[model samples]
Target chain A: MNRFKKGHISVAVVCAVLGFMISLQFRISMEQKASLPYQRLEELSSRLLDVERERDKLQEKLSALEEAAEKGEANSLSDQKASEILRQRAGLVAMEGPGVIVLIDDSRLKSKAGDNQNLYIIHDDDLLRVVNELRAAGAEVISINGQRIIATSEIRCAGPTLSVNNVRSAPPYEIHAIGDAATLENALKMRGGVMETLAVWGIQLEIQASENVEVPAYKGTTQYQYAKPAGGGAS
Target chain B: MISAVCGLIIGLVLGAFCPLIIPVAYSKLFSVALLACLDSVFGGYRSVLEDKFDNTIFISGFFTNALLAAFLVYVGDHLSIDLYYVALLTFGFRIFQNLAIIRRYFLKKH
Candidate 1:
């Protein structure tokens, strides 16, 4: 019995120590990953813009060279510039402002399954249209469920749930943003816009305006090595 | 592919970051339940990963705890509290969780 007691106490101590280490490691693993400096995003966005501009110049020169050659003139790069212009906008530099997050959730919203007159199920397109109008209305930054809306963000239907930028997000969808809320709301609520369409469809739009909204750091890093935009001519 | 099981995967994900709300006991249970549902959805991937859960009754223990923290964090918004300290939750749950595990295994065996 004495030996057994000793073994048990030692084991307990070991377990306790192990648990503590686990706890500490857990704390470290999920700690806010040294917030990759806010300025870094801005800087990276700038570099993207710079690359696009350089591409634009190159495109213009090529167009000029081609055009001049066609006409057998000295300036031949103008034609390439035309093609570059056709490429329109490129990179993740395009964004909008401190904005509003309109959470449309099932919470507090009564829905009658059988009642034909009062059905309130929000759909994929409902959000899509809202995001589309925000883009159109010049929302500087927008995110549904903490997922930022970079230029290539995708919001789509994943069964009953909606995925913002490929991450599944639920009702009471938190839209994080940094933009002019009044203008962004106006863009969304503009006539025949996403808001009106949702209203017409009878979906509730919960708009919360905030001055300082910290959009969650984007989860996955973006990779774009091959799909460079055409030498920027159009924009 | 497996993450698509039920709506649980999303729920687990959402639950994983669910803010801790209500009392600690209730919050902890809520997280566990969501995680259990998540495990059931995943066909016990969480538990199967463990070598005998005698020391861990619930599958995805960390995930359950994290979900509770998530609930607390979001709830903090309404309550005007800052509950983002995940380490506290982790440490707090350890003793109780271990006791529960021991009791469960021994009591059942005895």
Candidate 2:
């Protein structure tokens, strides 16, 4: 009886019991607090995501419906503009699959080592041209550097590098565009295309035609608590 | 202009600072191994990954990041090596922040 009241073992037992009781109380409280807010947060986020997803899906559906209507309709600049505008409005993140890769290295700008100008470095303008022509040819998805190029995307030049949608990228720009291989190539090869423009500038342009193109996900955050659909809701 | 000179100075200063701050190579090997594991685990389809991520997600991320630190040091240029320390410190800071958050959320006492 005296020993039970005495050493480290007894102290440890008492401590453990106290700890367990405290933990039990804490756990119950956490569960209680977590329910209301956690459930609400989850529900709201799920709702927001569902709304965004439906918007994306419906945009594509609308465009397809419009195109079907235009199939036998009048031929005018207005029609062309409308279709192009529709494509831009229906922005979707491109995913990748089987695709051709064109490796263009400059023959005149010789260098086998670091900072060689001879290496086929795709510029913003070059990538922009390719993407534009591909979209015109009815390519579904396009990507570079794992960043999917949505319809509203912008490609620009920023001091010694290229920026697509304001993200910096460099060299042998792997252009993954998904669509009908033959149709896309035919469009790219047409006058004032990706290849033609580069060829005239003495910069080597390589053409690769593939049946499948695997695009990567865009690397960035998607958040804007504001700067949004402002104060309206059509979705 | 002054801005050009300032930029040049900053670049040179960073370059000078790199070698001093970079840790030895063994740490890098550890980091690379961790990254390889993460890569292998997340390399494919979604069905396997989603459920595992719901709880205890931070454990995997912490291990992955700790490993990356050593790696970035190994491959980093002079400027990057200096920045590596800042990354390390930032990492530690994040742990403290997370602990506080978890304590507040779970323990209900600050």
Candidate 3:
């Protein structure tokens, strides 16, 4: 009777292990199913690469045209002026001048004596506030984490990461703004300004002035289907 | 059989409630180990029916078989080979063979 009991107990233990494993596998697979958008991300990234290549080709063409116009070729002054306006409106021109580069990163210090661990990480709103301050300080062109800021650009959070212009960006966000470097730096560091507020939240921020800060051209397409030039004539 | 059912029920409940999550990278190892465990359980059942079961051998074989199967999968992954299928096929065949023996034993008794 004792021998039978021991054998029964051993079999029972093995069955328990098998059941646990099967259930664990089921849960993991369910989690994987819920997080299967990674495949969609892969497809979107490939599409983005293709779009970037096309943008590069178009940029090269625009630069060639600009050079031809400067050399007094078959380009008129009015045509050049129109192209400049269009380029600026479309955010197609790379900006460079004396400007400020603001680096915002998650705090290196570990959270202590608090349940609010989010205080150590830079949020989307933190970036938005900094960008707003830069714009108020008269920044002409700005790019955050290599994504150019356009009129239609969006800054938001996606899960554990921040999305700027629909691209996932982690902490240590490098914000390059083309404007007066001193003014931008002062605006960020002003009394009760963005820097002070971020400091209170334990986010690390550094503002540096540079003689030349380059902001990349917007890579996204601009489609204007609904709004035409008012009065139907090109001014 | 009743004890096995009770233990399996308890394990399923624990697994469902446990918040522990296995990383995706080691999921293959878990799957191979599960197969090896299943194979071991069937072998143990067959031995018990044959009156040749040893507790020490059963426990040791259970752990060793699972570890060895998981190791085989890990090695195959690093070596860029599909050795998991080999483990799966062999263990899976053995499970069926053991089940057949158990079925024949029950049929003879009836």
Question: Which candidate wins on lDDT?
Answer: 3
TM-score of each model's chain B: 0.29, 0.40, 0.93
- Which digits, one per residue and each the tens of the lDDT, describe model 1 over residues B5-109? 323333334434545234533443343333333233223232333334222333234346446555766676468675544534554455456545556656776
Please report the candidate that would top TM-score against the real structure: 3
> If the candidates were sorted by their TM-score against the true structure, best first, what order would they fall in?
3, 2, 1
| Model 3 C-alpha lDDT per residue in residues B1-110, reported as the tens digit of each score | 79989888878887888898999899889999989988988898899899998887887898899999999899999999998899989999999999999999999999
Q: Which pairs clash (backbone N, Cα, C closer than 3 Å) in model 3?
A: none
Interface Cα RMSD per model, in Å? 14.8, 26.0, 1.3
Q: How far does residue A199 in candidate 3 sit from its true spot (Å)?
A: 27
| Residue-wise C-alpha lDDT for candidate 2, range B1-110, written one tens digit per residue | 23323433444444443333222344344434333333322321121233332212333443465456655655664445564555555555654554554455455533
> lDDT for model 1, on a 0 to 1 scale?
0.56
**Per-residue accuracy of model 1 over A1-235 as CA lDDT, tens digit each:** 9954553443343333333333333333354243466568889999999999999999999997787677865444556765554332322333344668787754244556665532466667777777777767676566787776766778787877888768887776777656678887888777887666667555678777777665554455567778877787944
Against the correct fold, how does model 2 do in TM-score?
0.36
Cα error, residue A118 of model 2, in Å, equals 13
lDDT of 3 by residue, A147-169 (tens): 99998899998877888779898
